[model samples]
Target: MFNGLSAFPLTPMNETGVDEQAFTRLVENLVLANVSSIGALGSTGSYAYLSRTERQRVAQIAVECAGEIPVMVSIGAVRTRDVLDLAEDAQQVGVKALLLPPMSYQKLTDEDVYSLYQAVTSNISVPLCVYDNPGTTHFEFNDELHGRIAHLPWVGSIKIPGVSVVPDEAKARVDRLRAVIPKHVTIGVSGDTLAATGLNAGCEAWYSVMGGLFPNTAKIMTDTALTGNAAEATRLSRRLEPLWALFRDCGGSLRVIATAAELRQFTTTPSLPLPLRTFTGETRQRIAAVIDELELS
Candidate 1:
């Protein structure tokens, strides 16, 4: 049921634990912006970094704040059993769907990946979405594996992160996946910078990080692209280029978005777990310049 921009918000954290007030505000912001769906605890949400209780709290808050908008909770974990447990917990909290990435400490084989999904889908009553984010999981899904995953019972959609830096090449990959995957299964694209090209390539939904902070802007771009308004979509994409560049230079969107959120006073500067650095002063200034230039602040 993820058909348009599904906002993947960063889980706002404070010293003690999840900043529940800030997290609720962020989710409410997405709903107010009318995002197609809310993806709680996705990569952007730092699912792996949070404890089970923290994640459950995040999911519950998102579902509570989302109102009519669907909430998709990421149930991915290093172990299949943990994934299944998360899936069950999500169901209890009235989650709309489960997003599972094939995660492992060591490299995983195709069969291993397939088995992990199979185990969860077989147990969970809710629909499951395959999240193939090679950048985070270090596991890639080939075309054959995609076809097989799409055929699995209860699997509804696949989130493919746009890997190619070239626009045409990224589109080509989306086209190829669309051709092979089951017609019933929707192909959603991630990678906010390439999202316009991906939507133009016929991806039905966008699993977006930027959308979490600026859903209205993302919705306009995706809607324009989906409706064949190429010129309008191109303009919107160009407008977002500076922010996208900061995302790349800062290493990821988590810190950049968190910093933006803090600047806007949406939330306090979150305390990320150790080993994950906050944005540098120079980077924050650059981000501030882009935000001001875009009139996002």
Candidate 2:
């Protein structure tokens, strides 16, 4: 489940509630594209903005739509009890794995994170993927902390945010991580722009935002990079430089992706939850141009 392209699709929504139809279409499209796995409620899925009932329903929809394709749902929340319940909810729907990011309002210590994993792992049956995305969570995990959590039962994979873009530095980063985690736990890289470098550096999986929406393109990049064709993989990533540039300039991928999705007619405007708006004006025009030029739609 952790290996290869694990696509994280958006949970598109509107004023009423979860846009079940659009969300289902996204999941069904990924299934058709045959991504290695479907990560339904990861950060790309706007997991943080959803209510419990909404999340549970999303999980059910993803599992149902994915069919034979493996489904991993994010169970990350600020509270341990909430995390536990979320994990159970995902498992009840027959999800293949769980992704947990150490989210906290108060700063989290290494011990706090380790204990949280220990508690959750003991209770859940599915494999757990450690989500080490500090940009949103505010909890930067040191290698020592990762080594500690990696030892717990059911620790299947570690989703590192992104490795160094430089080739040697990227390999060194993955090497250092591999030395700490158990051999059974695969190392997956997030951050779509750096995916080629990370994969060429030896990470086994990609927890990708782009893969969720544009599965065929992302999968080709993944398959190429994993096969050791460094030049071609780099070329593939370079071709998408326009999209990556948007990710860089816009603050993050969430809103930009939402805008792209809206342009493609996959979802309506206000695809994101309240208080967070998708791009408008010239920014939206630029994204639309990129989508057309790159044929992302």
Candidate 3:
């Protein structure tokens, strides 16, 4: 059922760039945390910035370190052809699954979305997990879209950002969607704050940026939540709330990734893609203070 925590680790980069050694360390650390699964080239891995060759190399490295744990590669792109190419390449990499979301405002109709999904599914043999973050795609996969896509044999999961302007509203939407979707297909929450809520609402899996920084603790919290211990899950989540706040307050995805790497001491030098700026000195201190206040190393 793809139950439990899946840490989406950042693909670390060093002086020479694409620090394979650091990446291996990152993988080994998460493996020791006993993560049920790991995703490569997802948002945290900076997939949108990496060249196709770089993505392939990182996917191979992730698969090598993944061991028996399932590894899923995010194969999304601005173009459908490129998305399918990545999926085909991922199938060759032996990933347990592949995820792709429509991008570049590419589709205006259900037919367009379905055709895009059909092409990727036809090309890839492994299970397909749909990445449904409208925050990036500028397109939301409504319930009808989800029901249509969920019927595909290879479509095994859906990953959606659990963020909302109003918590109650978010819960209502998730609950409604849960009622319609089949119980077999895994529903994964993307953010830490929504992990407990999503699970309580019937989500079976979660992928988190905070998990990448603190894999063991994330696993513990997720395991507790899945076992129906809402009290314990709430306690553990309170501890993570500060960090999640930092991720949100720090402003953008690049800052979140850079701040996480900096806090964890993953790499001395971290870089974010263009059209994004690095964290300021004050913001870094604020992030550090939150970590210290939470007593999280």
Better of 2 and 3 by TM-score: 2
List model 1 lDDT by residue over 1-297, tens digit each.
779889988787765788888888889899888889999999878899888888888899999999999999999899988888888888999999999999899899999998887788789887888999998999989999998888988999999987475667877888788787888899898989888878877789989998888788888888898898867787788888899888888887888988887777777765465456567578778888898898751
Per-structure clash totals for the candidates:
0, 0, 0
Rank all candidate structures by their TM-score, best first, as comma-separated numbers: 2, 1, 3
Runs in model 1 deviating more than 4 A are 163-167
TM-score, each model? 0.96, 0.99, 0.91
lDDT of 1: 0.85
Stretches of candidate 3 above 4 Å error? 14-16, 105-107, 163-172, 252-254, 275-277
TM-score quality measure for candidate 1: 0.96
Candidates 1 and 2 compared by TM-score, better number: 2
Rank all candidate structures by their lDDT, best first, as comma-separated numbers. 2, 1, 3
- Scanning candidate 1 in windows of ten residues, the lowest lDDT window is 269-278
Candidate 2: tens digits of C-alpha lDDT, residues 170-215: 9999999899989999999999999999999999999999888889
Residue-pair clash count for candidate 2: 0
Candidate 2 clashes between residue pairs 3 or more apart in a chain or in different chains: none
